[model samples]
Target: MSLTRVLWFAGVIITLAMGIRHSFGLFLEPLSAGGGRETIAFAFAILNLLWGAAQPFAGAWADRAGARRVLVAGALAYAAGLWTLAVPGMPLLGSVMIGIGLAGTTYGVVFGVVGKLAPPHRRSQAMGLTAAAGSLGQFLLLPAGQWGIDHLGASPTLLVFAALTLLIVPLAWPLRVEGIERPSQPVGDAFREAMRHPGFLLLSASYFVCGFQVSFVGVHLPAFLADRGLSSSVGALSLALIGLANIVGTWLFGHMGARHDKSRLLSGIYACRALAIVLFVLLPVTPASAIAFSAAIGFLWLGTVPLTNGIIAGIFGVHYLSMLGGLVFFAHQLGSFFGIWLGGRVYDSTGSYDPVWWASVVLGVMAALLCLPIRERPLQRAEAGA
Candidate 1:
């Protein structure tokens, strides 16, 4: 009953967090009225970068202090950030706060609670369910966000979103699980241990690709579709399709992770992503094709989150899962920073997304290869005399 309640509330929190996040792309054109695209993109870049940088600390804090505290604080930060963002000339400050909020509210911290609540056998599925909830949010909110932009306009929509994020504070209460014990290992020791592990490093590097690929798509795909003369609705639909398909993909991968070798599954996912991007880019542009591409790419979207976090838990144990996961996620955010900033810079300079598209394909393939070599087995601490 406790686990079920935690998962339920966690899912709702993720749904709100991810849903609002996925809508940022929809605001680009509308927000463009106030400034150049790069300025907005740079703000998002800062958000991703800061989110990544803060994740380890947030995760560590959650590991020490409990997710409820971290999550409530994050929720407040997120709401405040959105309110700030709605103000003109405050994108940087707003993004910084939002980034910090994301570090606490999203998978890095949430998954730690899930990992602790679910047994080893069910961990992957629990994480998957949470991720799917996030996807569902994306599915539901993308179109809603577009509608808000079309009707209420960007600033008002941001304010509304800010108000909605406050819900996370209330939702976070159910996540407080009492009597769970922590391992004796110092947090610093765990960090050093993971940093020394080759598999952990490789996983972090590959996750960087995931961040780069998805962040670019999330922030830039709407504008890309517009460049192809498609309507904003089509762009909204494409993003929603990705979210819809991800519901299945994340769940399927999460189920598969329990029974299969997670590293291989990750490899296959990245490979599929590369292929999907290639097809999406090479095919002639149409609403149908765009939707098709969205489904294909979206199915592959966040599957990595469950599988990657699952691998971390499997190898290192859940005691430090949040912090370790945060370390890996930080690498992903770094990629997101480049992906978003570079896309805008390239577009502003060359007026094309081709370079970034090709870059994604290449990165995807590399990530696929990188995952092939990870050692997913838990560390033999006793054997190593640690």
Candidate 2:
């Protein structure tokens, strides 16, 4: 019942969930050694799609049945999904299972509980701290994952990660809310209301760009660096740098979200992302430059998470925060599906990632424009508790 206790457990769980997820890029080289770049990318793409598609349902169930149930189930599935990756012919199944598992274990379910635990005034900060914990995981775990692949074989490394993921099962208990927080309106009515809101639509559209840009970079950046004659360690360090910067960025943005206009903040973050990508690509490829780029992009990374969720909570109220956030995240994942799959397709055909990099810049500008118009206030119905 203590907010501290809840945030602590929730933060650890996110660290594990997101940390491992971020390291998936590290596996691409090892997996693609047999010439299946698209295959691996598609598997990851499926993971994002399934995670997005299942999130609303997962969040809804957490809203009603409690997050412990959803999180524990998700942890089991996540572990199973990882173990399944050891099977030589079942990457698709592994990806699908992991995707569904991620839906239950990560943002939607965890934020649902945290949203209820923290008071409205401190809500954005709490979410930011929790998301920062995830960035910390990325910072710590990326190198560890790369080490595992270096020492143990990739399959063995995956098995170890599977074992580690099971830790989420016990971590789920501390996150249990005291009681269900019922929505002010029926679930169907909430969905319909969200559908009619222009701001939510615009927010979701911009989030799609977030997903497209982040996913493409997360999955393909390693290969892109390799194509430029960088070592695998450079690639791993680049992702770790992103994670490291994300810790500050997520926390800073979350703290600011409490004070500023979240929509405008989001617009700036996207614009910065486009600028970072442009600089990274146009400049020469070197380890120092990659690290600088990673740090810059990373600072802007996942800053979107807390801000986006905070905006949704502001607009919809916390009672349906998880479900509404899930809906918005589904848009993000849809962008992820395209961005990642497209990166692989383009690279496979053109032998370069230049086109997708340009596409990300274009989408970033569009998202920045889109965020300018979002009305961050709650609906009248929500304010009135109708």
Candidate 3:
């Protein structure tokens, strides 16, 4: 298949898969209203853990088998998870299954394939474009999810989402590669080697903050807005704007990664996130303020994905891209688990999200600091040097 076609297919898969995943947080309130916030939060927290846990295996499968198999299986799991989620009293089941589904369909698997397909010069741009599609999904689907809740309620809306995930089945076909690309080292050895590299460790550590902050907001922001006496539609619009801003942010960063030090770019993005969060919290929460905050954070949202992937590909090469990326993402999901779980726990104890917001701000600064030291070049290996 043509590279253009591959990118198109990969982009659509990301959009649909991420669209449903991003909007699932909308159901947190409706589901938890009965079970209490902790129950729902735990379920989401588990989902993040499972999503992270499953990623390395999913990526390895894609690397060893093919993207087609992993993606199709994910699409099926996604449909089942959504269907289960629609049924009342199945939050944990739905969360675990959907989290499992997302592992196969999301960044590691899709971008790994794209990394292999795109030429070296253009790979970052391809990943940026793909990440942008995921943001576009958030922008396009948040309102649709909000609309579904308004008209159909959460259960039926999830059933609608079950149908939506099925769309990924066809999209995965184009990503099927002829064979695994040759790696500089065996997959097993690469993971062991990368783990020892300071740059890789720093990259993973910073990504944890990314997962923590983004998942916290993605899952809880709607309810956060509701707590402030804003309409749910306002929350929906805010999410849409975040998604819209991500399109530009992701593309710009992708282009810049090609030309600049991606590590500095990452540091810049993280610093921007810290400043944005501080400004958001210090300022009063008005409808205008809320919308502006969404736009600001959304630009920084998911922009890290391509740059991180580009760095990994630069350091480790594409042969083991999926596996390495997934391992890095696992750290991200660990942070995600804490972020989602803590948001509710803190709220349940204090009746405020103030602490959580401040924690994220601090993490943003730490992430910025860590990102600066990442070596954005290929890993030095005796085998490759020979």
Give the winner by lDDT.
1
TM-score of candidate 2 against the unseen true structure: 0.98
Q: Say what the RMSD of model 2 is.
A: 1.5
Every model's TM-score: 0.98, 0.98, 0.97
TM-score, structure 3 vs. true: 0.97
Q: Looking at model 2, which ten-residue stretch has the lowest summed lDDT?
A: 377-386
lDDT of 2 by residue, 1-386 (tens): 89999999999999999999999998877877778589888998999999999999999888878899999999999999999986776888999999999999999899988888888888999999999999999999999999999999788889998999999999898777775546657888888989999999999999999999999998898889999999999999999999999999999999999999999999999999999999999999999999999999999989999899988888888887788899999999999999989988899999999999999999999999999999788777734543
lDDT score for candidate 3 against the true structure? 0.90
Look at candidate 1 and tell me the lDDT of residue 46.
Answer: 98
Q: Candidate 1: RMSD over Cα atoms?
A: 1.4
Error of 1 at 75 (Å): 0.4
Q: Candidate 1: which stretches are off by over 4 Å?
A: 382-386
Candidate 3 RMSD computed on C-alpha atoms after optimal superposition onto the true structure: 1.5
Residues forming the 10-long window of minimal summed lDDT in candidate 1: 377-386
What is the descending lDDT order? 1, 2, 3
Stretches of candidate 3 exceeding 4 Å from the true structure: 384-386
